[model samples]
Target: MSTVIELAPGVRAGFTGRDGGVSREPYATLNLGGHVGDDPEAVAENRRRAARGFGLDPRDVVWMNQVHGADAVTVTGSGPAGDVDAVVTTVPGLALAVLVADCLPVLVADAEAGVVGAAHSGRPGMAAGVVASLVAEMERHGARPERCAALLGPVVCGRCYEVPEELQEEVARSVPEARCTTDAGTPGVDIRAGVTAQLKRLGVTNVTHDARCTRESTDLFSYRRDATTGRFAGYIWKA
Candidate 1:
């Protein structure tokens, strides 16, 4: 299932949970990523179900290769957008989808400009400035940072995101807000905090996030918790 919100009068955005699909076993249900070893037919059917849930045709949804890099691209149509972490579009009725298990799925929309963008930011992608890349693409399409609203959600939270101190320091060197100490006193990285800080610094103050931690929530998928699990997605479009 999905929980949706209107970013603006005509723009819609939502994140999906790990339910309502035909995948079996570890994937269980609602596994949308095609390259994740789930049955290809199951992945395709799940994607179609997700698109239809948003009243979109399966062929009209735009997806990405998602290498967890700092690259973002602009797309005018559906299908695989590119080997990028984010996809931005000004085309109405074109939905941008980002798949993530523990990583952050960030959705951006500038209702006034009719532009929407989606990014998949893991700790690496977050430190690498993928969100910045997304905002930059949105700006290129007549969207002003201050006029954009962003949604971050269903991620692996700070408490469960323990990391090596050196790696944590590495990420902190770039996005200080990501540095965290877990309840157990180990270094951790909070992707949401880091992303929110990045967005605010870039003049995007309108932000909303889900407090649910994928690792902690059974309703969502978590790679850290289940090594070979399914991936849910966040989608944005103008309807």
Candidate 2:
């Protein structure tokens, strides 16, 4: 059930599920993230397999230690993973990857600019202006927001992601059109909608979203559904 979305002609990205990795239960198969307390060997093997799906070498992926911040780093040659929320690059054969469970995985590409980006968009980061920062960072590398196309991958829906009243107020204060509460009078936060609105505000050309919810789908790993479960990845690159 890991669905892949092709945004532009030569740029492709997808969210992987737990069906293809080598981990056992708890971390159960196909877990691609290494910092999730899964076995190192098993995680490494899983990453290798997932990398191959993009016709890329496993070592070519530049992973990041996401801190739910607004910083987006640019990678040139393969080195080490940095502490950031997003990554953009024009380098060929290097995949910009983001690991997520309930957090939104955002795939972006400017086909004409030969630029591709991947971002882990959670409430804190999105509220802190991660999407806008990402667009700006890409622009620094010659990618224009009006020419950018975005794909929002699987994430927890608002109905399942209830929050506190103060948190909702804070999100609303920061993001326009953010769903601060549900119809049942429960406080909630919709990270996906916040990101969508932000993209629209930035004048992004296309924004695509999938209906799948990681917490609701048994095919994908869910952090909130199962606290100790493994992590899945969303990746994109230019070929």
Error of 1 at 179 (Å): 0.6
lDDT top scorer: 1
Candidate 2, 65-184: lDDT as tens digits = 998898988888664558899888899878888888999999899989989888889889888998888888898889988899999988888878888888888988989567656556
lDDT assessment of candidate 2: 0.85
Once fitted onto the true fold, the runs of candidate 2 whose alpha carbons sit more than 4 angstroms away are 1-4
TM-score of each: 0.98, 0.95
Per-candidate Cα lDDT values, in order, are 0.91, 0.85
Candidate 1: tens digits of C-alpha lDDT, residues 1-239 = 77567877789988888889999979979999887899999999999999888788899999899898999999998889889999999888999999999999999999999889999999999999999999999999899999999889789999999999999999999999999988799999999999999999999999988789999999898899999989999999998
Which pairs clash inside model 2?
21-30
